[model samples]
Target: MWTAVLLACVGCYLLKLAGMSVPARVLDHPLVERVADLIPVALLAALVAVQVFAAGPGLTVDARAAGLAFAFVALLLRAPFLVVVIGAAAVAAGLRLL
Candidate 1:
């Protein structure tokens, strides 16, 4: 497990390095610029989805999902980031307590 973790860390570092090494001309391409702009948002959404719904090898519909739903609503309502986070956590904890 430690070896796998080490390898993964090294691989991630190398991948980042490779991205940094790309020429400015390539990065300046219209398509590349668009993709770069959107990549972080896409990745964040994927990560949030996974964390909210994944349970080991299967998917779950639990308090975390409820929390995420509340968070989404809060975002749509233009709530502050701290409010969004607290609201989500409160919802999840409230649901779990019931």
Candidate 2:
């Protein structure tokens, strides 16, 4: 397990280093900059769609939709991260209990 963890950490660090080491010349290209800008938006859209609409593979909202909405509200209100998480969890629990 320790070896596996070490390997995973090393792999992650290498990926991060590679990301940071991208040459300015490469990233300065207009096409590269455009694509890079879109990448984050695409990723965020995919995440939200997956979390809110997904069902299989243990990713479904099921009875957690209300809680997720509440969490979004908390985020809009600039709540702390812990409060957002706990508020969502509490709402989810309350929903599940019904």
Task: List the global CA lDDT of all models.
Answer: 0.97, 0.87
Best by lDDT: 1
Clashing pairs in 2: none
Give per-residue CA lDDT, model 2, range 1-98, as digits (tens).
99999999999999999999999999899999999989999999789678776778666656578877988899999999999999989988988898
Provide the global lDDT of candidate 1 against the true structure.
0.97
| lDDT by residue for model 1 (25-83), tens | 99899999999899999999999999999999999999999999999999999999999
* Total backbone collisions for each predicted model: 0, 0
Each model's Cα RMSD: 2.3, 5.0
Least accurate stretch of 10 residues (summed lDDT) in model 2?
55-64
Model 2 ranges with Cα > 4 A deviation: 1-23, 29-41, 57-61
Task: Name the lDDT of candidate 2.
Answer: 0.87
